[model samples]
Structures are given as C-alpha cells and as structure tokens.
Target: MEYPLAAANACLNAITTVALIGGRVAIARGNREAHKRWMLSAVCLSGVFLVCYVMHHAQHGSVKFIGPDGARGIYFLILAPHIVLAASLVVLVPKLLWHSFRGNFDAHRRTASWTWPIWMIVSVSGVIVYVMNYLLWR
Candidate 1:
C-alpha cells in the first residue's frame, strides 16, 4: 500500500538538502549570518521531517518493497546508511547547534565538517529511497 505521507517526508529531506548546501555556500562566501539562517532552516525542516515520519509510520506501519530481488539488494544498500546516518542526526544536529549557539565557531565548524556530509547523505538517500519505493516500484 502506498502511504501519501512518505512523499511529504521525502520532500522535506530534499528541501533540507538544498538548505544544507545553501548554508555551506553562505559560509564559504563569508556570510556567517546567512549561513546561520540557512542551517537553522534546514534543521527546522528536518525536525518537521521527524514529526511527519513518525506520524506517517504510526499510521502505515512498515512498508514492504515490491520490486525485484536485485532491486531489493540495492534498496537495502542505500537504506542501511540512510538509517545509520539519520539516527546520528539526533546527536549530531544538537551538538552542531550547541556549538554555534554557545559562540564556539571553531567547534561548530569542526562538527559541521562531519555532520554536514552525513546529513546530506541521509537527506539525499531518503529522497532516492522514496522514489525507488513509491515511484519506480509501484
């Protein structure tokens, strides 16, 4: 069965990915305030994603993939890291915000260097997983 809320979650992930990139570029351009705004927006979107995702899964429960076995392997491949990294966000994101909020730019930057890429992968892979599950397979 197709769950409509999954689409919304995927969109949130995609939007967060864009915001993450925007924040990175802003920092590179020496726009600290812009960077802060963009990153905060991304975090907010991600928080929304979590809420929507929980509501979504609570309603729909687990979804089984309908694709071929070969595709199933590929799906799990992407899903594994997405799951791991997405889980890490709970810790990584708060630490990131704390560093920035406490005026610890150096710590923030260091944490971002790792957190950013992990978050990006989780966001992008989430969209890809949604497509593979809802669009392509179905």
Candidate 2:
C-alpha cells in the first residue's frame, strides 16, 4: 500500500527548494543569467512535481497521517498551508514568470519578492509533510 510516488515527489520538492535558493543567490550576486537558469529549472521541476502529484493522488487518494495524536496537530498545521500555497503557485509562478519574460525586471522583482518566499515555504513544507506522512507516521 505504500506509494513510491510520494517519495519521488518529496525528492522533487527538495530539489526545487535548492533551485529556488540557488536562484535567489544568483540574483543577489547580480548574475541575471544564472538566476534565470536556476529559476527556470525550479519552474520545470515544479511543473513535473505537480503532474506526478496529481497522478499519485488520483491513483491512491489522500494519505492520512498515522502518527501519534500529539503530532497529528503538527502534521495538519504543516499540511494546511502547504496545500493552500501550493494551489496558489499554479497562478503565482506563471504570473511571475510572465513579468520576467516580458522584460519587466521591476515588476518581476517586486512580484518575486513575495512569490519566492511562498514558493520556498511550499517546497520545504512539502518535504516535511512527505516525511511525516510516509516515514515518521508510518
């Protein structure tokens, strides 16, 4: 009954988190090209993760937490924001990318200031959720 896809998704999230961090660093260092590469990689990986996530959930449905009652609250707390922000990324990411693609650095940077943090939170929380659901809880 274990879904390997859950683990794969977790790995994807981890990589995406690294890519987002890399993008941030590249921009801070004024390496626009590197920033673009890192951000695009993060976007591509995120897209793949989204597809895989849907596939896994469609086949297996949602994974319920099996951890101790004390930790169940923590798991739900982590999961709720992850779900909400993850859904928002579908729109946020594309809008942020569009600004960059259109050569509007000012707007892009302004948007990214907020989008990046939210994306990072979702990516990191996703890995935490995966571990809690499949490893710790199980």
Candidate 3:
C-alpha cells in the first residue's frame, strides 16, 4: 500500500507537471479555455498527489541511500530542493487557483509563471528521488 501510494504520487506528479507545461503551450497558442482547463486539472491532480504523498511518507520513514557518504550527501542535496519547492508549491497552488477562478487573467499569468517552473522542478525532482530511493538504492 505504501509503495503504491508512492508510485501513484510520482506518476500523478509527472502528469501534472506535463499538464502545467502543456497548459502554457495552450496559452501561447491562444487557447485560453484549454489552458485554463489544463491548469485547473493539473492543480487538482497535484493536490491529490500531495495527499497521497503525505500518507506515504507518514507510513514510511526517510529512504536511505546505499552508497558512500559522498553519494549520500548528494542525495540529500537533491532531496532538500525537492522538499522545499514542494512545500512552496503547495502554498502557492491554492492562491494561483483562486486567481484563475476569479477570472483574473493578469494575476493568473503572473502566478502561473511562478508556479509552472516550480511545479516542473518539484515533479522532476520527485521522480529523481523515487528512482534513487526505489531503484538505485534498492
């Protein structure tokens, strides 16, 4: 159950990351409605992942790296950014969603501009963390 939660969290995070990028593309293509839908969906999916992610981590302690001290240090460095940005993303996401829902285009654009890259970083870092934990160190 824990691993499945982790896997689902990773998969959904990746999908939402892509959705955020695709939403930007949709905006660039002048498909405003499509962009809105995609962005909203991405936010929702990420929210779901966040909840499952919390559950997984609550059930499972920190994953260890099976390597030299140097490697472990590097792993923690990657983990730090992922954790920090993930926390930021959670706090900012709702504000972004609210602005979008209120039909505030400028506010949405500014918020999305910040959210997109952070979301991508959090998502990609999540996969890296998962691979390092479940595969490389397994």
Candidate 4:
C-alpha cells in the first residue's frame, strides 16, 4: 500500500474513534453543537478516506489474500460486515448531518442512535481490514 493511502486510512480511523467518544459525550450532556461538529468532521474524514481508497484501488487494483486454516472464511466474514457498514455510513451520515443541521434535533438524535454504532464499527473494522491486508497477509 502507498504511504499516503495508509496514512489517510489511519487518520480516518483515529478521527472516527474520537468522534465516537465525542458522540458519547454529546449524548450525555445533550451537547448538540459538539455532536454536530464531531459527527460532521467524522463524515468529512471518512469522505477523504473514500476518495483515497477509490484512487488507490483504481491505480493499483486490490490486494489478493491467502489465509490460514479457516482464515478465508473468517476474512470474508469480517469483510462483509465492514463493507456493509461502510456503505451505510456513506449513505446515512449525510442524512444525519442534514437532519442535525436543519435543527431537527429529535430526528438527528434518533438517526444518530443508529448511525453512531454502525459508524464506530465501520471505523474500527476498517483498521482491522487495513492491518489484515498490509501486515497480517504480507
């Protein structure tokens, strides 16, 4: 993997992890502003990751995998969840940002209740995928 792509992926993971923390704080304190800021930042960060991801894939194609015993099944298992949630985040984060920005606090909160956990999973799983591709499989 290119250093730039790896770096961006790492940053995206870090920022989303922070956003999850900030999101918990927002929920506890009812801090809508902070919630909006952190969530939006997370979305933007993920967007950058997406762009870098597509570019890298387009330029270099995907890395092939060879796994240990049962590792092939496990790898696909992990990959399914990550891909599903990542796609969800791509679609849903904007809806969340829109609702929150529109001052629809109730709707935002409702949507985010679902979005936050999924986003967290996506972020963490993304890191796992990266590690598996570059480190474990290498």
Candidate 1 collision pairs = none
lDDT of each: 0.94, 0.94, 0.82, 0.78
Q: In model 4, where do residues sit more than 4 Å from their true spots?
A: 1-4
Q: Candidate 1: what lDDT?
A: 0.94
Candidate 2 segments exceeding 4 Å error: none
Better of 1 and 3 by lDDT: 1
Over the stretch 1-138, how does candidate 2's per-residue lDDT look in tens digits? 478889999999999999999999999999999999999999999999988999999989987788999999999999999999999999999999999999999999999999999999999999999999998857
Per-residue lDDT of model 3, residues 23-105, tens digit only? 98999999989998998888888879878877887888665567667677777898899999988987788888788789887
* CA lDDT, candidate 1, residue 60: 82
lDDT of 4 by residue, 1-138 (tens): 444676577668877788778867886898867866776677777888888888778876876765576677777788899898888777788898798778897898798788888988888888877776666766
Model 3 residue runs over 4 Å out of place are none
| Candidate 2: residue 89 lDDT (0-100) | 92
TM-scores for all candidates?
A: 0.97, 0.98, 0.89, 0.87
Q: State, as a TM-score between 0 and 1, how close model 1 is to the true structure.
A: 0.97
Candidate 1 per-residue lDDT, tens place, 28-59, comes to 99999999999999999999999999999999
Residue pairs clashing, model 4: none
Between candidates 2 and 3, the one scoring higher on TM-score is 2
Candidate 1 local lDDT, residue 88? 96
